[model samples]
Target: MKINFQGAEIHYSIAGEGEATVMLHGFLESSEIWEEFLPEFSRYGKIITVDLPGHGRSGCLDEIHSMDLMAEVVLEVMKTTGVKKANFIGHSMGGYVGLAFLEKHPGMLQDFMLLNSTPQADSEEKKEIRDRSVELVKRNKPAYVTMAINNLLSPKNTGKFSEEIEILKERALKFPTRGITAALEGMKIRTNKTEVLKSFSGNKILVAGRQDPLVNIKELKQLAEESGCGFISFSGGHLSYIENKVQFIKLCISSKK
Candidate 1:
């Protein structure tokens, strides 16, 4: 189904029954990524997936789709489903949106799992990379997508997961220059939400890949400990959902509470 958000069309999907579970995809990804795993999730409860602004079938709302903007869109979509609260399983950029949601609507959350993501904002070094990435996306989106997706997995699994990488590239290549750049810009300016997670009354979990190129697993585990959130470490990289699909699915099913 679809909804009108700030005059832009936002596409979302609903499946199964019982408790509501919202799965948010990472940057350059659409709700389509959850198609294969929806069956497992739906078996336990209602699963809701939405294409953030400028991604998937959704239309772009602005030149810079900040986390707050995307979080608002998520809230609007959930309300359309008549759900006042839902479990969160957000991947990468989606996790950023989830943090934004919790920060804005603290009482509207049941449980949260940040998969291969963090509540920390970008450092100056990362911000520099993001700015460069934005320029690269604008100059040549296909090349940037190709490089970005490949870098997400552990270098050791390059040959083993070639097919999976190809699939990611194929879908990511469909994203528009504006959509890609907007996401990068938003991430670049995101604020640190470590306190937000620490203060969340609901259950909080952090799932990370041991060799994630984008996120520092050590820091994630430390944050989890300091914030009193449960932490799970998968034996792979940033794309744990793809790198360790079986384990990732098990974690998702087991963590549903």
Candidate 2:
């Protein structure tokens, strides 16, 4: 179903009949990424997936969809659905939004997991890259999307997951160029939230991809240790859930407790 928040229509889906579990998709991705696992996940609890502000069936909100703005959307969605507290799982950009949620509603998180994501803000180098990306997308969206999806998977597994990558690219291509650029702008300016994660005493986890080109594994592991959150590693790239589905599912189920 869809709801209006801040004058923008947001798309979301909820299934099952127990505790709430919110799954937020990453940049260039929609809630569709979680559709395959809905049946199994819903069996464990009420699973909620959102298209966010500018992806999937959701309408774009602003030229810059800031993390806090996205988090507010999540908050409003939860209120509309009568979810007071829920387990949160975020992938990539979705993780930044999740951390914002943790900060905004500390009492509302039963558990949280960062999948192939981090709590750190974009570095200066990354910011420059994002700026370039915004301009590039405006000029050639498909080219960037295709290249990005290609590089997201480990080189070793690219051939093995070629079909899946193509599907991802197809979906990404459908996302509005404005929305894509807005997300990039938002991610570029996000604040560091490592301290926020450190203070949470709930069942928090950080699933890292050893081969992830985007995240710094060494720093992430250190963050996990310093924050006292559970750490799990996969031999894949940024899209750990796709690169390592079986292990990802097992970890998700175990976190349901």
Candidate 3:
């Protein structure tokens, strides 16, 4: 269903019933990305899937949708749905927003998991890449999205998941230039929340992709260790939910147990 938040329409869906489990999709993706895992996850609890502002059916809130702002949007959804507290699973950019949420509303998180994501902020190099992405989005959003989705998957699995990749690209094409650039700017300025994860007294999990081009596996593993969170690795790229679905789901279930 859609809710008005700060003059923007936010889209979200909740299914099954039990403790709450919120799933936030990454950049360029909508709540639909979590569809395959919803049935299984819902069996455990009420699973919520949300379309972050500027993506999917959600409307943009501003020129830059900061992680803090996005987290507030998620909080609004939970409050509206009568969820006092919930476990959170975030993918890529979604994870960044989760960190922001953790910092802003620590008591609200029963547990948290980062899928193909990290707690670290963008490095100088990554920030430059994001800056470039903003420019690319303005010049050619389709090409930028295509290149991004292709690179997110391991080169070895690209052919295997070619159809899926195309579909993702199509979905990404729906993003307006303003939204795309806004996300890039927001991600570029996000603060490092490794300490937030470390101090969290609740259960946390970090699932890293060994072949992920976007994340530094070694760094993420170190962060997981330092934070005393469970660490799991998969032999795939950033899209481990698709590349290694079984193990991913198993880890998710086990994390909550």
Check candidate 2 and list the clashing pairs. Answer: none
Candidate 3 Cα misplacement greater than 4 A, ranges: 255-257
RMSD of each: 1.0, 0.8, 1.0
Where does candidate 2 stray beyond 4 Å?
none
The clash number for model 1 is 0
Residue-by-residue lDDT tens digits, candidate 2, 1-257: 98998788999999998999999999988999999999988989999999998899999999999999999999999999999999999999999999999998999998999998999999999999999999999999999999888999888999999998898899999899999999999999999999999999889999999999999899999999999999999999999989999999889997565
Q: Work out the TM-score per prediction.
A: 0.98, 0.99, 0.98
lDDT of 1 by residue, 1-257 (tens): 99999899999999999999899999988899899999888999999999998899998988899999999999999989999999998999999999999999988899999999999999999999999999999888888999999888887888889998898889888877898899999999999999999999899899999999999999999999988899999888888888899988888888664
> Which of 1 and 2 is the better model by lDDT?
2
Better of 1 and 2 by TM-score: 2
Query: Candidates' lDDT values, in order?
Result: 0.92, 0.93, 0.92
How does candidate 1 fare on TM-score?
0.98
lDDT for model 1:
0.92
lDDT at 217, model 2: 90
User: 28-141 in candidate 3: lDDT tens per residue?
Assistant: 888989998988888888999999999998999898999999999999999999998999999999999999999999999999999989988899999999999999999998
Q: List the residue pairs that clash in candidate 1.
A: none
Q: What's the best-to-worst order under TM-score?
A: 2, 3, 1
Q: In model 2, what lDDT does residue 70 have?
A: 96
